[model samples]
Target: MDKNLIALIKILVKKSYITRTDLEVETNCSKRQITYRLEKINDLVEAKKLPPIEYGNQKEIIIKTETKNFLIEILRKSYNDKFYYFDKRERIIYLYIMLFMNLEYLSLQHFMSSLKVSRSTILNDLKDLKQELAKENIKISNSRSKGYYISGPELDIRGYMMKLVLLSLEDDHNSVVFDSIIDDYHLESFQFSKKTITELANKYKIHFVGDRLDEFIYIFIFLKARLKNHKNLTEEYLGKPNLDIISEMKEYKFTGELLSYYKDTTGFSEQEFHYITAWILAVSVGNFAEETEDKPIISEIVDRIMIRFEVLSGTHYNEGPEIFKQLYSHIRPAYYRLLFRLPIYNPLYPKIKEEYSELFLLVKETMKPLEGLFDGEIPEEEIAYLTMHFASIYSKKRDYEEVVKKNALVVCSNGIGLSAILYNELKEMFTDLNFYLPIDAVKFKDFDKPVDIIFTTEYQLHLIEQNIPIIKINPIINPRERYEIIRQVYTLLDLSVFKQPSLESIMEIIWKYATISNPTQLYSELLSFFSSSFKLKNEKKEKGYRLIDLISEDCMNLGIDAKDWEEAIRISGNSLVRKNKVTQDYVEKVVENLSPYFVITPLVALPHTRPEFGALSYSIGITVLNRPVEFGNNEKPVKYIFFLSSLDNKKHLPAMSDLLHLLNQKSFFEMLDGTKDKKAVLEYIRCYTSQSTISSSTME
Candidate 1:
């Protein structure tokens, strides 16, 4: 159980080989001590029924990877052994929990023995702990009788302890330090309280979003274990809600149910319900469990906050009342945290501050709503959490549409599992065009799919003739590859192809060379000139999509074999061109603009071009594919192509709405997907369109 032997086992577990001399050089163990401890390690591994540590013939320390790890966990968990890895922060936390428990006399030797660190390490930790606690005006007094003791107001001490635990929970690597608290104290009380809270939470349909509930429970148990020393929320350093206000809320009743069982053992007073209620409300999100209307005061604050945020961030919530509802839901918990002086740790605080520095500062400036409501300045951590809500609002205002888009094909080796995962990651990153399911690498050469870029895991793909850009990538792409893959895909695309003549560039050519006094008028005329296509595109969208009005019965083609999305577009548009509703130029224009965005709600393409592009009349062409064609621009493959030729935008909005309604019907898609008869598809659209448009109030 020597720390040195544990350290040696840790080394052996990490490395493939370590010689007797290497072990001595790495560790303080002597040659003889190394010989003896190897026997000890073998005995431990054998006792666990694992393969014994082997000293290889050439003097390498040969240990089974499993056996060495087993010994390390044993030393890690064993109460008798204090051989574990933790940082200075973790050490201070472990020490704080110890002193907070007030379990025994905790001297320097006791600290050294418990933490398995040296005396100097414990001394420095206590120094840092003191400095940290002093900010809250809390003191860690040490006496000869009691080695270390934490003294502060009950609420501050409890909050500080919980804040420490919450900060620890924010870390992904500090589970060892987190788990130590369970081993160190209150095993049964912690378990019982967790089970109780969990059962009640589930029964009430309450939920926790992330690690908030876990941290909340640990802090609760710590406070509950020391109930003999502390009473309910009587600390008057900060203001809390009056009795009538607390009793009026739904949490009061829920608190009664939660604390009724603990009343006898933990001796909960009347005020304790308010204290426990604040804790419960801070973490719970699901169903906002037992949510009632916010108090009038809090409601007004939420309103003011929303308006103030809109002004501060220069963003408008024009969508609906949904954003307001969400803002209130999030701010309710935030209000409780601020009002009760409850500190939370936003794990995203650093990233938010770094990435959203301007938004963070703006949100901080917009905290006037909570100004008179709370006594103290809101914690920066809380502000970061609040900033996220506003940042989402602000981000939604920007048009994130990618100007230059390309079709990316994912080709992976062997099984579809890894390839499927890679496909999803790419889908999330490139939202404008999430590729269809991944294809096999072997098919990459003969693949007739429409692809602008090929992403393959196989290295041999580079040697092949991928007339399209082929990016050879690893099966499991790391962060650098993820970034580089995106960069490479964008680099492969020729942006000039997508870039039209902008007003500014045109003006630069005109104004830079020729001076004009009527610049504003010239700018307007040039903007109108440049926007002719935009006007046509917008105008073309307003056609009434009644059954026979737009969906020409002569145009519906079912189950035709198409090579690619381009071919699919042409087949649908051919009927419209032949009917003189569109020109061949119109068909080609539709092909040029054939993006995945034209794809229907599910597996269909509805490609259209402007009236300026030879849309001679309003008509529709429908073609169904025997096989789905991957557009390389959407999650779904195109099964049916609907070519629309519009001569005007007038009344097109309602028609587009009707079209969306038709597209959403599952039976319509099913009929088209299966029916060989073109009449069946046209008849279904006819019946639905008649039923829908006949109900229009404007008809009255």
Candidate 2:
């Protein structure tokens, strides 16, 4: 088979439906060549007695279920076979792994035998690998004495080795590449290393998220192999405080115990234990981290990253400490991943980049603080994951009066940000089903909660002995998979499916009666209008209140004689209680949450809690203090307090956005402090907000 065509075929097998443009762009082929390839695929399938693939009217590549399954089986089988087809790039990486692991002397015969290629082909691959290594200031040399040894900074060589292993695993999530590697290599320690990793996970109760267990096994199989050859790591990058913290972490103890079990095979050094502990913690989900707020290193890093986000995105967010704590949990693992150059594959990377392009770029730029821990450029995969967290935080809220038809469980083994992103997507797509997301895979099998259906990833439906129906969902789903999920879930639940109104038929009727003044534009507008209308009907939700709806002169107060910050919050929030916009419970929570650090700027502070605590509706009350009170630092006292209450996350963004901008101009603060009249302060704020054209466009 032609290599390019086979590659395209494999992609088609992975993604059942893709647009013609996307296919061409990914394959780097012309339209004419795509047509020829399609014809070639059809011929091959026809020879195999399978249905032919065709392009649908929507430019989607259409194939029958049987044909797709057949292609998948064939591809999987080829990866397992000894005579597996080795492309130029994979063959070179294959050579890298083999060279690193082989104890016996390497020769033309050895390379040819391992790759199942001709001697000349193996020689050419070696020449290419040498050239590529040279770019990293590494050299590959052959000597009769030390056969096929690579010479460079040993650290770079190990980093390259880890990068290759992760890259292979990323491409082949099924672990076929790793299976072949361990089986073919002459490394005697591979199986023992694999066994020790398995024991570590089971004995320590470490839940490696979503195929990460296999990744751990594969990474250490080579790592131990290198260590047995006495290629021990020589450098330590962390400072004393960080080293002390990691050594004190629970994962460090687990690493120590794991090394003890394998002490006969691998030396138990303090450096090796710390190095192993870092990577192990990097991969595990929800490792038992201390709830102590005093971890200054990770906490400071999270605060700095959030500050950067606020600067680059032009949004000020005061989400209490919960958001901070959640971000801290995520960044703790990420710090290690970057520190050790451990590659993470985000399957949702392309989708995140295309959908949240501006947010993604801003996040990438603002993540300079993260590189403080590492010397290398932060990977795009890591950035995209962070973007998802911010996207969830700053997602513009559209109110949908959602009705519950079925209680569905969304089982995603990826961490909180990814699971939250998936849940948001599902919520918009299927308004009828109430999704309780992000239940860990480790917990799903024994879950006692009532669930009508399950949508999961990476795990099969029938493997568990559950009676509830399941539909496997992809994080970055194609059109057909999306359609199948909706259709299957709805059908299983016996819910009435709403048919979309025929826009084309409606257009035909309009064409019969309407004038021909840019029918195309009219049709386009009508299609958009109808889709939005249909979407709204399905969602059945109300929009959130804006700043204008919540803030006015009636809620304004000035020159209040508050004794302290707690008193300031309650005094400013009097109108919210008088109007029944919030209960006393909400006000008390806000008062309790007030700290010197809660002050956004030296001049102003906006205080809030979760919507359910006491908020009955959207409201904002303002108080300009007569004397500055210490809501933040002692030097920077707060003169303004905006007590805000929202029904949910979406309703308060516009209000926050407006308030942030007004506080941005020092003149706004100066005017508020200058005026003792409540009406004057209210009028000035209204005038400033009236000219501002900010919509729900900001993210945290």
Q: Which numbered prediction scores highest in lDDT against the true structure? A: 2
Candidate 2 C-alpha error for residue 436, in Å: 3.6
lDDT of each structure? 0.62, 0.68
Candidate 2 lDDT by residue in tens digits, 1-700: 4556667776676442355645766787777888888888788789999889878322456777778766666566666666557688788887887666545677777778877899889888899999988987678788887678776766577667777766666663545556666777644344676677767778767667665665677777777666776766665443523666778776777777766665444564677777778888788764326652226777778888886565434345767376676677678778778877666777778877765555676677668656755876898999998988877776544455566777878887677777666667677777767777567666776778789887665443232236566565655444434544554565567777756444445665676777768754765566456545444344543434445667767677777888877788888777788888889998887676554445555566777765767888788888888988777345567778877777654445455556656766889877877877766776776787678755433332
Give candidate 2's error at residue 227 in angstroms: 1.3
Give per-residue CA lDDT, model 1, range 1-700, as digits (tens).
5655665665564333345645665676676887788888788778889998777322445555567557657544543335556667778888888777666677888888878889889999999999999998789988998778888776677778888887665532134565666676644355676788778877766555434556767776666656644544565633565555766656677677866666454466666667767777776552323446455555566677765554333234554376666566667677777777777765556755554455565566568446667776888887776666654443211233464366678886523333544565465455545364577554466767677766654433132334455566543333434434554454456533223443444565675579889755775565455444322122232223353567766777787998878788888888887788889998887787655546534576667756787887767677888888887565568887767766543323234445556666788778887888877777787788778733221000
TM-score of each: 0.48, 0.64
**True lDDT of residue 454, candidate 1:** 65
Q: Runs in model 2 with CA error above 4 Å?
A: 1-72, 99-113, 116-156, 172-174, 188-196, 237-240, 244-250, 256-264, 287-325, 347-354, 357-381, 393-409, 441-498, 501-534, 537-700
Model 1 residue runs over 4 Å out of place are 1-86, 104-106, 109-113, 116-120, 144-147, 187-190, 231-233, 248-250, 260-266, 286-297, 396-428, 432-700
RMSD of each: 24.0, 8.0
